[model samples]
Target: MDFEKIVSDHKCRSCIISVERYQDGGFGNIRVVAANKAHREDSERVFNHPFVPDSPYTDSLPQDKNFEDFMYRCACLGQPLHTYVHVEHMGLWVNMFLLPLESDKENIGYCLYSCDISPYADSEQQASLSAETATHVLEISIKLQGAKKDDIRQVFRDIIEDIRKICGAEHCCILYHDITNRKYINFCEAMNPQSPLQPDAIYNNEKFYDIANSFDSAIRGSSCLIIKDEHDLAWLESVDPDLYSLLLENGVKSGILFPLKHNDQILGYLWALNYNVEETVKIKETLELSTFLIASEIANYQLMKQLEILSSIDILTGCKNRNCMNNYVDDVISGKAELPEPYAVVFADLNGLKRVNDEKGHSVGDSILRTAAAILSQVFYDCDVYRAGGDEFMLIIKDGDVDETSIKSKIGQLKEKSAIDTDVNFAAGYYIANKGEDIRTAMRLADEKMYIDKKEYYAKHPELKYR
Candidate 1:
């Protein structure tokens, strides 16, 4: 067969690949037998070397098991395959096609591989999925689009379960990575009830990130890792023995992993364990399409959460802002949130904030406010602290868990500590509201008592002027 003529006829970058077959049903040495002019020219332009014939495919392209597996299936099994993939290392989208070529020799199988490269992904090419795969991907997108802000977490869990069932896997997990912290930020995993896997106990953010980080190099910079058989495991073992052992110990016989990426940033990883090995190709195809939508949705969800935190939290004092306190009060009044039978509302006013701001700069005053918040947080461990306004904080403490005596002692300790540390002083007071009592009443009484206590603070420091 004139392999050169066959590849040369193709318009795009095309090549003839030969796989060395063993008598015992194994394969080795995937070599590029011939390349079209376009392929050779492109190779020369990018790699700064001429594409030589009868060279290892890795010499021309990346050593990707997924690519090798596709070639093997096309050449040896006579199954033509087509896939549109994002080549992560090169930051390019490649539309690839594999067609089995007629081979006269049994020991050597041939496949014609052709690809059109693009800097950006083509939406039409991406949408060219099998009907079943298209349906699955479409359903996920619809669910994500319909989900409300409050429903996002549960919606994500439901999606994970759906993906797990679709892959016929024992478990499916989506683990988000915080690259700056080297931590597993968020995780959503679906598992069979009987599966002997840790639900949330075993792995922490730091401990599991090591194994996750190793997958990039273990796959030799491939976008995803598909460990279908012992051959793939052997490759992993050779590259990372410890990780290989860890997977084996965790009953990971076969798995597929795809990174949840957004705008070239790896948001996290989507992986399945003990999946149906026979459906590996279909699973990969479905997930490749599905992950695109999932990653985008997760990224938007994370962004919204960060915005919500910024809106509800006080930046200076690291406590809930007045807006958050108002919402909580509304929730309690509207019966959206139920408080216990007896509760207390406490007001903590920083006594010397104005004096500090006038004497020193506003930055020093800001530090004093933070110090006051820290002391309040330390004392009111089981309560919510809100920065109601400048130099004023509010706490809603449940009374049954902490009695009045304990609260008074803690307040006394705060006063003594603030006096010793010249940074700040506290004028704190609380009012307990029993069943059938209004929270507004407790808040008003707490505020009045706090004002009364402020006079005592002034008396304690007669030499210093009080505003």
Candidate 2:
């Protein structure tokens, strides 16, 4: 019988690995000779290699004495063997069968077939454990879904703690990427109390970006990454010595890092450190279900925050809008707000806005508004600046001594600066409120005084008077 042909013709769900006896009495290097289509794809994905005829078996087997002795017994006894084995590298439990092939009354080789039986191992117990973990993850998802913006950090802290426990890890942390700020924020973290690693730590260095870039390139489409030893750290060290040293300093002998992806974008990374091989496998499987929910929750929270910001900001001037002003007023009126004593209100309107809009077009008028807002922001840098109306802005000085003359000088300098380019001008008035005075009364007085300033501004420059 043609053994290779017969193996190729045999169709089953099992992946077949074949080994031939060598002249030295030991088996030749094992090779994957045949597998059904389904097994072929699974083997390639999980083991990271295709099962081609005569190709060396590269899948890592269980690293235990029992497995080594079992294989020895099978080869020595010259009898068919069958048993359950676990592939440590792939983190899979498989049902294994070995059949000896003979030629001319001599054993020449053995055919080994393995079928993945991980799902059925202690089926009842696994089902119960899976159900419990699922319920816990669902609870976290629900809390994130309903969480307020202020509560998100606490919720993430709880998630990190739970993940550390589930993974049997010494430490776990979530690193959030602040793209705009160009920093990696440690959003949350948890650690075993007796573990040497510090839970509250920051990694803010340019070298971290290099390490992240290298890691992102290496694991482009992979779901997770595991680093078991110094060999792994060598690659990291080649890319970034600082980052490698940082990890080593934290006592990270073994660790896993997985991306929190949303809509094809990586928002952050989740990391677990110092988990044993078995614990690492369990954590990987558990996170396979949990990370999706976590990513969705984070995405939703970010969306809500962005929407809130857009709703309360003036798109044209980049200042807080009238909507924000109304909310502030409501907060003060309802006694839910407190202002530092000796506050002041400044009301200002852009001069010659109608003329700029009519003569230079609305685009120029918009530019002038933005420039005016920018100047006000710089001058009243410590105050709340709001776009209160078309061509008008309000500043609420919550605390600080009122240097009226100094503020007027800054406004005069701004007017001169704008005159050289944008040719814009400002008419402004301010009213300081005593400790017991009503804020609204002070604002009204400031508005009235602003009209007086506007009249004087137009009188000095008749060419800018509104038609």
Model 2 stretches astray by more than 4 angstroms:
1-13, 17-34, 37-54, 57-129, 199-202, 228-243, 276-278, 335-337, 403-406, 416-422, 461-464
lDDT tens per residue, model 2, 1-467: 45445445545545444555555444445555556666666667767766665566555333332233234334444555554433433545556566554434243344545444573344342333345566766676677777778788798898889888887889888887788987677878888988987644425544675566555554434466666556556755775566567778766777777788787688888888887655443455567557767887878877888998999999999999999998887887678898756778889888888888888899988988888888888777887799999988998887666667766775677566666655567778888777677778888998999889889877887866552
Please give the range of 10 consecutive residues that has the lowest summed lDDT in model 2: 60-69
Q: For each candidate, what is the lDDT? A: 0.85, 0.68
Full-model lDDT, candidate 1? 0.85
For residues 1-467, what per-residue lDDT tens digits would candidate 1 score against the true structure? Answer: 99988988899999999998877656798999999999898878887889999999977776678888888888887888999988877878899999999899978899999999999989999999889989999999999999999989899999999999998888899988877777775578899888886535425523466877876676565667888878878887988886677778677788888888788777888988888988887889999988989999989987998999999999998999999999988998899989876788889998777878998989999888888998888877777899999999999987455568877887887787777677687888888777678778889999999999989878888876675
Against the true structure, whose lDDT is highest?
A: 1
TM-score of each predicted structure versus truth:
0.93, 0.73
Off by over 4 Å in 1: 23-25, 179-182, 194-207, 456-466
What is residue 382's positional error in candidate 2, in angstroms? 3.1
What is the alpha-carbon lDDT for the whole of candidate 2?
Answer: 0.68
